[model samples]
Structures are given as C-alpha cells and as structure tokens.
Target: MKRSRFTEEQIIGILREQEAGVATSEVCRRHGVSSATFYKWKAKFGGMDVSEARRLKALEDENAKLKRMLADAMLDNVALKDLLGKKVVTPAARREAAAHLRSAYEMSERRACRVLGVDRASVRYQAARPGDGVLRDRLKALVQERRRFGYRRLHVLLRREGHAVNRKRVQRLYREEKLSVRRRGGRKRAMGTRRPLETPLGANQRWSLDFVSDQLTDGRRFRTREALSLVVDTSISGQRLARELDKLIARRSRSAVIVSDNGTEMTSRAILERTNRTGVAWHYVAPGRPQQNGFVESFNGRLRDECLNEEVFASTAGARTVIERSRTDYNHVRPSAHGGLTPEAVRLNLAASRLRNVTSCAGRPLPSAQQIGHQTLGLS
Candidate 1:
C-alpha cells in the first residue's frame, strides 16, 4: 500500500475547507488530492474539529500500540510454556541458556543448570567436531571452489577425499562460517525452464558462443567477444566475429553446430556466409532468452565474477592479457563439474576415445568429412 503524504491535521483542514463552502474540486486542487481522496477524508473526519481530530489520532495510535503489546505478550507466554513443559532442549541451546542465566543472575553453574533443567556436564562440554584450523580451511576452500554445492555434497566430497567428518558437523560449520550458496532470485513470471542442449558424443561436435561485457581502469568499456577460439575482439561486428570463427575452424576441426544468442553479429550476412562456407550449422537461442544458451552464460558469469571484476585493465593489451590468462585457467587449470576434469582434459579424453573407436574398427573406413564435422567443439 502507498502511504499518504498528508498529515492528519492537514487532511482534516482540507476536508474542513470543503465543508466551509469552497468547491470540492477547488479544495482538492489546493490540497493536491483527488476528489475520491477528499471524499474519503470527509467521511472519516466529517463534523470533527482540529482538537477532536487530534484526539482521534491519539486514540488510533494507542490502539496500534495495545495490539502490538498484546501480540508480544502472547508470544512470551508461548515461549515460557514451551521452555517449562513441552520443548526438548538441544545441547547447544541448553548451554547457551545456562550460560545466560548464570551471568545475568550471578548464579552458580550448578544452580543455573538446575533452574534450566539441563545437566551441568552437558553445559560445560565443548564439541570436538571441525576441531582443527586445517579442517576449517579445507572446508572453506572447497566451498569457495564449488559455490553451488551445499553441505551434503560438500560432505560427500570431503569423505571421498578422506576427511573423517560428519554431515551434521559440516552443516554446522557451513552455517557458522556462512558458506551457504546465495542463488540469485529471478522474476516470478520469467521463464525458468530451459531445454537441455544436446550433449555432443565426441570432440568438436558442438560449440556455444556468448559475449561478456566489462570496463577497464580508464572507464573504457570492452566486451570479451569470442569464446572457444579464445579470441577477445575489441569491437563486436559480423566481420570480426566471422574472422574469429575462421581462425578457430582453421586450427581445429569444424564443429557440427554453433549455438549462440540472436545477436546482430551472429545473424549478419558475413557470419551467415562464413557458416555456410564452413558447412557448419548455426543454432540461435530465442530472443530475450539467454538461459537457452546456458553453457556460455555460465562461463560469462564466472568470467565476470572471478576475473574481469578482479583486474584493472589499463588498455586493450592489458585487458586481452588478463582475459586470455583467465580463459586459459578456465579451460585448462580449473576443474569443471564433469568429474573434476578441466574442459581441455575432457576434450582431449573425448578425442582419445574417438581415436580408439576408429582404431578398433580395423577394416571400416574412418568417419567421413561430414561425420567428422558432426564431432563437437565450443567457444563462449
């Protein structure tokens, strides 16, 4: 609800003017109110003087205060009942309450325990879980590395890595260290569902492309314009984009499909001609639906959060150097969700697998040119 700007006395004065022979429309105009608002005010404060309106305002405020007090009192009563009769106190809570009572009332620890109905030994006991600094540091590092993984998955990974820790303890440390993943909330009506992109069966089968924008130290804005090929174009255009694609295709095998957003560069005649010349398919995401190009979008997010935001690029050369280094780390050094292998490692593994498949086929002819093009490769 929108709050009214006028005070109670001001509202009553405006209503009183309408009652004093001023035209209703004139009164509304003077007071900056609509006829509906004037009528509503008149209905509420009609026949009341300034003193009477003041008294009525006081009564309304008092009523609100009383309602709040009543609510708080009821909540207190419930809490007291739970503490005395119904609730089961956990060890942590028991210790916390006992310590509070002992300090606040200057009571002995034994007396505090007796009053709280908790054992003195339990109150004095300290948990041995997540005991050492090394364990906490490792947990922190894991959480930083895997931002999306919650306590359960983190616990599983820790166990796999031979960390003898309990899930509940991991969860407790996760809360205490505040390592929970904070996912961005989207619009309620925004498209939430994404059709999964067809996963390629071999290397060079498919590629995803997306652009990420950022600014340098001198306030000059630049976009990291190409992925997969690892080219960072200063300007975004069809010619620039097509040239990068040509370079990538010349170096690596032509991918079957290049997935991208419906950007002007991707749709331009130059890009279209290049794709046609290379005999590769271009698949565009729906307009305004970036999530449809999820792989590249995810890469763009990491590029911004981990690299671009961390660097102060003084010039195009500096920007390129930083971005290229980060891209290398992303593709070759950083472990991906694909069984903890880097993207380069995964691609190499897939290529090796394809090679073995061909070798095992002895008499069969190797895959044709078109079939080779069907193998996947990507840039984002």
Candidate 2:
C-alpha cells in the first residue's frame, strides 16, 4: 500500500505526452521514472483525460471505503453471534466482552461497543467503587461460622452485624469469591393426577410423622423421628417410636390423626398399640407417595439441608445437642413459610385467632343439645 510519487493528474499528463507523439523514453527520463512505469500508466489512462482519471480515483476511494465498511459489518455480526445468550448486564461484564471481541475478532473498541449494544464510554469507564477486602474477610468468616447459609441469609446476618452494604454487592462478592453452596441433583418427580391432602384445621387435628437417618463421625447410625414440627432422636425401633410419641403427646395436645408412611416402624404392633391406647387414629400413606405425608417430609428436608448435612457429630450426645438446637432454632428462631413468622410465632398467632373467635362467640346464645345433634347429622 505504498503511495505513488505521482498524482493521477500528473500520471495522466505524462500519458498524454506519450499519446501526443512524445517518445516514452523522453517522458520517463523527464519524470525520473522507468519506461515500464510510463507504459503501465499508458495502459491505465491511455484514453482518459485528467477529469476522467480524477473520477476513477474517486470511485476507487469509494470502493475501498465500502469494502472496509462491509468488513466491519461482518466482524460485528461475528461478535454478536459470539455474545449470544451471554448476560452482560454489568458494566464490568460489558468491558470484558469488549476486550474479548477486540482480541478474538480483531475489532476496534468503538466497533466492539457498537456491536455489543453498549456505550463506548461505559466500556472505557473505570470503576471507582471502594474495595471490599474487609467486608470480604468478614463475609468469609461468617460463611465459615455458618456454612449452610446462602447469600440472602448471609446478607441478613451481615445487616445484623451493622454492615452498611447492599445485598447485590454481597451477592456479587459471593459469586466472585466462589462461595456458592454445592447442591445435589434433583430427582425425577412422579407425573400423574395428584389429589391434594386435606389441610389440618387446628393444632391437635392432624400430625405427620417421618424418620430421618444419619451417621455419627464414627459411622454409627442414628434415626430421628419427626412429628410435624417436633424432632426427637432415638433408636430405630417401634418401641422407641412409641415412647417418643408418648413424650411428644405429654408435651403437646394429642392429635386426632397421625399420618405416616408404610414403614415397618410405623406399622409395627407397638406403634399400633400406642395409637389405640392414646385413642388416636393412625393412618398410613401409599407406599411411594411421601407427598401424602408432606408436613414431616418438608421438615426432614430442611433438617437434612440446614443441619445434618452441615455438622459432623462425634457422639450420640453431641448429635442430640446439635439436633435439639437446630429444632429449637427451626421452631422459635428460623422464619417459616407462614409469612416469615417462626413456627412458635405461627402457633401463638393461631392461638390468638382462636381466642378471638371464642371471645366473639361468648355473647351468642348457646345452641340446644338437640340442635347440636341435628347439625352433626347434617340436618336442616
């Protein structure tokens, strides 16, 4: 792409001299060019005037410009295809993408920004935000203290400790530090028509029972029997289950119906006798349908996720202590799905609602026994 020493007008003038019967040798000698150069010019502009040569030069310039533009458009297309499906919401991410396009596709900065649909100023912007070194160290310490906590829960903890940081900032640092909790793959769900289970109307109306098993550090296994929100650890026997149920009933009101899966511990003679003695109805769900008894199943999932999976119990006593603490936290401290209220809070709220209903009914006249019997028989 070296530029020629002669302009188009000069080259055309020299060619005219050759066409006017001047010797090509004389023309070359006068112009300090070789005969080859003169003949090359003659072949190009032999029948062209200066105006035509100028027009040809302009066309060549325009064609070169168009070629450059087409090449840029093709590079932009390639950059866009490469960036497809990639989330570049942040300025830092866009800057990185711009750099990638420049290195990968040989695109200019302006072209890269245009192709990425980001402003060039944004791509060139330097972040002036303060560093999170201290915050990150504190966050990692909190993570070590509570390894089972996710970013949202950790954000809550940070706020409790009086850290003036945004939740999004914490999330960003959480990702950058690679502190994400590893999750197990999901199991395939059974697909079919599913009937919803009847919801409990009151505290002592219904209860779900389930067992969760885990191992001590010595590899000794233990089983925990969960009754709705209650958790008790014991040996894997129906006698122990009955004893645990008795203790649970002693502390709380006896439920009218107890739901459990078709496990041996649940269907054993000891459990059946205990239920009969307590005048409680024992119900068994279908063999592979754990969802039929979902209350305890959900609790067990949380226990496994937030407690059992996070702790290493050295002994049965240690396991019991940790599990009891986790149960206390779950019932009294941890927020439940009932509008972020804990289980204890929900129980208190339900009790308050029932009291209000009773107080409101206090002024109403009592129904006669015969009327109650008719209502029970669904008579008008």
For each candidate, the alpha-carbon lDDT, in order, equals 0.69, 0.72
For model 1, the local distance difference test gives: 0.69
Model 1 residue 120 lDDT score: 81
Tell me the tens digit of each residue's lDDT in model 2 across 221-317: 7776122333335465788778767876777757778777888888999988887788899888876777676566666676788888888989888
> Taking the tens digit of each residue's C-alpha lDDT, what string does model 1 give over 255-293?
788888887878999988987787899999877677776
Q: What is the lDDT of residue 316 in candidate 2?
A: 80
Q: State how far residue 363 of model 1 sits from its true place (Å).
A: 19
Which parts of model 1 are misplaced by more than 4 Å? Answer: 1-90, 102-130, 137-174, 179-196, 225-227, 351-380
Worst 10 residues of 1 by lDDT: 369-378
Candidate with top lDDT is 2
Candidate 2 vs. true structure, TM-score: 0.69
CA shift of 303, model 1, Å: 1.8
